[model samples]
Target: MSSDLWSFSLSTYAQPGVEPACLQLQSAGINVCLLLCGLWLGERGVAFNEHRLQQLRSVAEPWDAEVVRPLRALRVNWKVVAADDGELNALREQVKALELEAERHLLVRLERTALSWPQGEATDLSAWLNGVAAGAAHLDRDALHQLRVAVTGT
Candidate 1:
């Protein structure tokens, strides 16, 4: 497994049900980038703390809110029109790629945020997931658990 958050998120997201689970979490106002960063840190044995959690959130929230989501919304919205317009469909595809790139950049930013933080503390993946999900008002517990198992085999 790659130590970088982008690679980690890419691979984890390929696992079954992870995408829908992520969207479910995101719809509840959770920052998926931060959630993935929390998982990456947990896998790397970084200790969980409120300060660093907030640090990651501070860096990620705006990017996800302002850039990634809009690109995503536009792309998703184009599904109807794209089904009929070839040019529009091509543009939508480009938007989808751009949206992915945006998320990758956000993940990189998150990784950078944690770069200065010390490691060597073991944090449970489940606990980390819960902590990240704490701010989400409508999170589905089963989906979260399923996503956990899909990624961590736990």
Candidate 2:
């Protein structure tokens, strides 16, 4: 385990298949930062509950919508044009960095919010993943399972 949400996220995301799985989930409207936090909590054996899930969501939603999404939108929007225009490509790279930084900030906020929560009391990783992943109408179960397997080596 990485001992911190940001480090955990970085390492887990670097795992084989995790990036594509996360991208699939992200396209399904999941907040990747929040999902990573849930995975961190689950791996740490923190028990899952609706209240805690909501608390994390509350912390993530606004920052994601207001900060992360816009930067990502700009970066994604510039992708095609950026391939040709050196100036726009440079700007897009900056936007991509900003987007990553925004996600890192969100992870920090999530970790701070979860700092007081107890750990090592739960074993059902699916509970945490599913809870955070709830409400996505078209979620990819295979992609989610890929994340679980990649993280837990199960």
Candidate 3:
């Protein structure tokens, strides 16, 4: 797996079951970008410190709420008419690309925030997710485990 956040996210999301799992988590109002970052950190063996996580959240939350979420919503909304309207479908695909680019920017922001942290101690994937999610009840444990397994190749 690629070590960088952007590459790791792309590769992981491409894994079987991971896209649906991520969408499931996203539909439940959890931040998929943060979740992806957490997985990347865990994979890279970053220190997983609380301060680092807080920094990540602070950098990500507002942008995610204001920017990424809107693009995602717009794209998802288009699905209703995308099948019938070719023009709308094309627009929706453009929105999808914008949403992905927005996520890439978020990952870049996250990468910058965690740049100083040492990848010294390997952390358990589940523990890392739990920390980043702060025990969000909406998250699906089974899907999360599947994602973890997919990313870890275990």
Candidate 4:
């Protein structure tokens, strides 16, 4: 019942690795909240308003070049497939979904770091940048697990 999707990303990925266990748990309706929360957070940022998306795209340009572009290419290719190809399209959607989720998480984290800066700290941006880096590093560990689980279906 926790609203904090960040924490549950790890568990969500874990579920896929143990599919039989998860199916059993699902049947019993136990702790499905983690899965639900991950799904919710995973989808939340995929459709940001145009203005916000623009801002995010701008900020993400440098880091996103390598990661986002390939995912987008995959999504586009997936979209062009004939309607009868459901499985491939579904896989593409999942890949795109996870990429969007990661992007959203990073965007929010970057924004939070930016907002935390005081006017005077503009003179020494390195400290703020370091803090953001550390925070991202911490989040990456859990996010990686969540993403892996999402793709592999543990």
Ranking by lDDT: 2, 1, 3, 4
lDDT (Cα, tens digit) per residue for candidate 1, span 38-124:
888877778887888888888887998899989989999999989999999999999999998998999999999899777767757
Best by lDDT: 2
- Tens digits of per-residue lDDT, candidate 3, 13-43, equal 9899999988787777678889889888888
lDDT scores in order: 0.85, 0.94, 0.84, 0.43
TM per model? 0.92, 0.98, 0.91, 0.36
Per-residue error for 62 in candidate 3, Å, reads: 0.9
Q: How many residue pairs collide in each prediction?
A: 0, 0, 0, 6
Off by over 4 Å in 3: none
lDDT score, candidate 1: 0.85
TM-score of 3: 0.91
Q: Mind giving the per-residue lDDT tens digits that candidate 4 earns over 52-142? A: 3334335555545666557766787778782469898789879889776755565444354233222331222222212222322223334
Clashing pairs in 2: none
Model 2 scores worst on lDDT over the 10 consecutive residues at 128-137
TM value for model 2? 0.98
* Pairs in steric clash, model 1: none
Model 4: CA > 4 A from native: 1-59, 118-154
